[model samples]
Target: MTPPATPTSQGRPDKPALTVLYDGACPLCRREIGVYRRLDALAPGATVCYADISDAAVPVPPGATRDHLLARFHVQDRDGVLLSGAQAFLALWRHLPGWRWLALLGRVPGAVWVMERSYRLFLRVRPRLQRWAARLD
Candidate 1:
């Protein structure tokens, strides 16, 4: 089964929408999503579905559990490809303006390796950052 469409502002029918499944409960995640949302809103012809996976009412991805969604960043590209972690972020940046250059750079031979490793390291320290963010809120 496929996910539903993300109706564009112009209502033009196209390929499947690029949807970013995010954890709204996490301050870090929310901040990043907020940036992407703003960028997408300003970019013409860009339509992204921002799903709050932390919401109890939101449906879980086809085969993924809610915990899996919270553990890592996930994105469903227009091709219906599911991407996670650094790749997911890279895919998303490709749709945003200025950031598209960085996304292109990610396709370099060694860039993805480094980016994935960095994402793993960030995951390890995410708990501490979340705590700090919570305190700041």
Candidate 2:
């Protein structure tokens, strides 16, 4: 069984539950991340780190290139396991408060598989969405 989450003196977790790699330059991505960040602020027990892969200063995981990270959603869990697409989103959702239900759904048999497929479809149109979102900025 997992132990209860505890915050460090700095009010951050001793080890982050997940580190999210995102394309900070993308307006759509920023809006989504902003919602997650606000939810994270409301629930402090679990620590979620957000890294802007679009920023050269942010570090990329070993075996992953900057372009690869920027192209998709990715997250590193507490155990150092790297997950992308639906898996990454699930890991992140499990850390948040209200979003935990969505993460729980991911545990259902084949749910992740279906979600992954949907995410892949989204990737095909992501560039178009990004362009549209950028225009709104």
Candidate 3:
């Protein structure tokens, strides 16, 4: 079945509310997006577009692949600007009221480096974590 159309603020159905392309196969990535989806649902006037790129129908951009997405979060803001990894997380955080402080953390000394490093470590262990999750399933 086809998905319902995403509604727009100005009554235009042609544009996406907010595009969040994610890696569906990775458990950690899925969990992270799950949080975003829940937050979006609670926020008023929030229009989120969620797409899992593991589907064959999803078209990946240049220099981007399933592996790349598996390594980092990807989000396209309302204006079509693309952000990945820590920047993407920051973008999403900025939308939530209480979590806006996390966006400020992005500018602190060594914070971006730490976030990037932690994300890299997560990417490195994700495959093994997926295997464990599959076993549990």
- Looking at model 2, residue 136 earns an lDDT score of 90
The candidate maximizing lDDT is 2
The Cα error of candidate 2 at residue 28, in Å, is: 1.0
Candidate 1 achieves a global lDDT of 0.85
TM-score each candidate.
Answer: 0.88, 0.88, 0.78
Candidate 2 structure quality by residue, lDDT tens digits, 42-119 = 994648878888999776777889998888899887777888999999989989889999999997999999999999
lDDT for each residue of candidate 1 in 1-137, tens digit (9 for 90 to 100): 14566565688756546889899999999998989988898987776778898998888767788899889999987776789988999988888877889899887899999999999999999999999999988
Q: Which whole-number lDDT from 0 to 100 does residue 132 have in model 1?
A: 95
lDDT for each of the candidates?
0.85, 0.86, 0.73
Q: Is candidate 1 or candidate 3 better by lDDT?
A: 1
Q: Candidate 1 has what TM-score?
A: 0.88
For model 1, which pairs clash?
A: none
| After superposition, candidate 1 runs with Cα above 4 Å error | 1-4, 8-16
Q: Output the worst ten-in-a-row residue range by lDDT, candidate 2.
A: 1-10
- Candidate 2 to truth, TM: 0.88
